[model samples]
Target: MTMTTDMTNSTAPVKPGTLFGIPVGELGWFASLLMGTAVGFAAFFAATFVGIISIMAINTIGHHAIDYSLAYKRIGLPIGLLVIAVAYAYLATLWTKRILRKA
Candidate 1:
């Protein structure tokens, strides 16, 4: 007599922390720090780009030309993006924890 068993399926789900397809926990502390910092900087630059475009649009619609008069206006975007990045990183980590709990 012979007995057969299937081992191809898992009874419990697996959860892994990921950001942009990179397993967050698998990367050691230094690598994770680098990845997070890169994400933060990219977010900041993207926000700056959007801000510039917004300012240009406002100036063009209001005065029919590009205007670069306010320095404070330019500063807001980077600050806002920094906040967003921090919140995003924090939330992402929290989310990872929640997902891991399901495993």
Candidate 2:
């Protein structure tokens, strides 16, 4: 026998997932980190592409002149870390407020 419970008319409020006993709620820090990773990856690829193109054009195909570290280390990593931190902080505050209001 198989039985399924319908959730359409349920009146209970769904609680968001938590982390470290703190209610991260929706758009949690981990999710933000994942998003930041995606953003950072995109940034790194775009920056590398542009830098490589610029070096090829300006340096007249100087095969050994391009520095790849600038894109991922200096730009992309920092941006990703910043986004992760900022998003986590912002979401924490926002969710805290929303939860408090509901309480």
Candidate 3:
């Protein structure tokens, strides 16, 4: 068996990427909020679906009953809210600073 690997040069210069003439690091707060909202919305639906599946599996295999509302009210809501808040905060901090520096 022969093995090969690509080596990276530490001294090589790296370039920052840009979009629409704006650097990636300088994404705006509205963009951040939009991204967060999208993620949170997805998470909410995913969590709800998973939770319901788990509950159904339990009901079938263990003869245990779980309220479907628990998925949305407890598991899904908290996860979605947390994701949205964290994502928005992180992106806002990174993008908003560019504005302050310019002003």
- Candidate closer to the true structure by TM-score (higher is better), 1 or 3: 3
lDDT of each structure? 0.62, 0.61, 0.78
Best by TM-score: 3
Candidate 1, position 103, lDDT: 89
- The list of candidate 3 runs beyond 4 A from truth reads 1-24
lDDT of 3 by residue, 30-93 (tens): 7767776988999999998998898889889998878889999998999999988986776676
lDDT of 1 by residue, 5-96 (tens): 88796655444565556556465445656666766666666666766777788887787565543323565455656766784676567556
Q: Candidate 3 local accuracy as lDDT?
A: 0.78
Task: Name the lDDT of candidate 2.
Answer: 0.61
Q: Rank candidates by lDDT, best first.
A: 3, 1, 2
lDDT tens digits, residue span 1-103, model 2: 9999876975655465555554546564566556546655666566657665665675565556556566566655666566656765666676677668779
Best by lDDT: 3
The local lDDT score (0 to 100) that residue 7 gets in candidate 1 is: 75
Clashes of 2: 0
Candidate 2 Cα misplacement greater than 4 A, ranges: 1-64
